[model samples]
Target chain A: MNRKLISDQDLVNLYVSGQESALEELVGRHKSKIYTSIYLLVKDSYLAEDIFQDTFIKVINTLKAGKYNEEGKFLPWVLRIAHNLVIDHFRKEKRTPIVTNTDGFDIFEVLGFVEESIEDKMLREQGHNELRRLIQLLPEEQKEVLIMRHYGDLSFKEIADLTNVSINTALGRMRYALNNLRKMMNQKEYSYRQAM
Target chain B: MVQTFTQNDIIKALYHELPASEMVHLEEQLENDTEIQNNFEDLNVLKLKLDSLVLEPSMSVISSILDYSRSYKK
Candidate 1:
């Protein structure tokens, strides 16, 4: 999946040349990742959906108005815009809504059912639920790093630059995140074994 | 220094983010240290566990974003 085939720079050129499909392609390529990032943070399907739209609308206007420079990095730039908007949404609402875990909606659970081995699939699903629960318990810094690295597919260096931290610091947060999750899982397993 | 490594160190090594010298040293230790190797395996399992938890956005969200973007046509 060479999703980068249509480079951001090329997309910008196409948009500037009045190629509307170019804009559509750019949005199509990145909509999922962008929406996921927003959704993770805001935890509201409707609001996250709104911000996702607004992010691209802002992108379109910026590009059309000769404001978007071809800086060779599009996703992060757009993400930053989306991030800021989400922050604004929280500010206007004056209260951050609690993120409810919708039933039968987790992508991993759906993927788990597709696995051939029922026992292995069950283990994977259990581990995933435990991990998700553990992640919510993580400190803000660690949670952000895990989300960006795993979900957003950003490199540690990119994440460091985005979050204004040293690469080692970013790496360290991810380290802590995994370590904490492992400990949590172990503790959970011990309890389950004792019960059994 | 007896070169004590923590769970975090194991994760850094797993992600290939450790400094080259530290990575080399860790690799050498893993070759000879069963405990460290076990920790590495545990970290791998932990990472897979974490990776599996990502939920896909709803289909309505996807369609809404596309529709929202299209509404800006001048």
Candidate 2:
């Protein structure tokens, strides 16, 4: 069947009705967003992986028990689960999560790289690494809204509801996030030229 | 140029979430207003860059998730 044409709700229904591949399709369709959202928040690959698995485990159980009721809203629902799991981990660790690469873990280690020449690959990787670090420099609230809207594919209204802020507040956070990222990129380019 | 639009409105329109009525007027103003056009262009560039920053978990992690789902197959 043409799974790409299938809606998330249809995929969920198929998976619940004994089609295992449907579940795989669902995960494949959203793994990047789901995993990246988790990773960006926790800033740890191992913890992110664990929370991702746990999030899906909950999704599996909920689906099997016939309680998967968030029709037409699968990705955001899963994101909320992953978001709560990240929060739970932080609460248990008794430490606030910071948006710095203090641990210096290379997230690209687990990230997928596209086909490119050796030189091209290095340049792309460097670019991606720099952008990822810039994202880490954003404030936590701005980072959260950016990740939800950009990576989680949630609308501003959905983000506002999830983050318990007004839609305008969510939009403001996203604006700040993008503006900050743009400023950082420009500053980096300027410094590069100055050094050259 | 008849209505005042905020940066947030440009962002909303960029993400395709601005209401249709406002979008019609926003498009009109985008053609006439240089400042709004520039703001929209800058934000759009940033948005495109962000969109390219997708990352996926390792295959092992995906396998574990699939296995957990199969184990509880009803």
What is the TM-score of each candidate's chain B when compared with the real chain B?
A: 0.71, 0.89
> In model 1, which runs have C-alpha deviations exceeding 4 angstroms?
A1-4, A96-99, A102-129, B1-13, B16-26, B67-74
TM-score of chain A of 2: 0.92
DockQ of the two-chain complex in candidate 2: 0.61
For all candidates, the clash counts are: 0, 0
What TM-score would you give candidate 2 relative to the actual structure? 0.93
Model 1: per-residue lDDT, tens digit, A19-110? 76677678767766776677667765666767877887788788877898649878878877887797799899898646455533343223
lDDT of 2 at A75: 95
Best by DockQ: 2
Worst 10 residues of 1 chain B by lDDT: B65-74
lDDT of 2 by residue, A38-91 (tens): 888888777788898999998999999999889999999999999988889999
Error of 2 at B73 (Å): 6.5
- Which candidate number maximizes TM-score? 2
**Native contacts kept (model 2):** 0.66
**TM per prediction:** 0.75, 0.93
Error of 1 at B20 (Å): 7.0
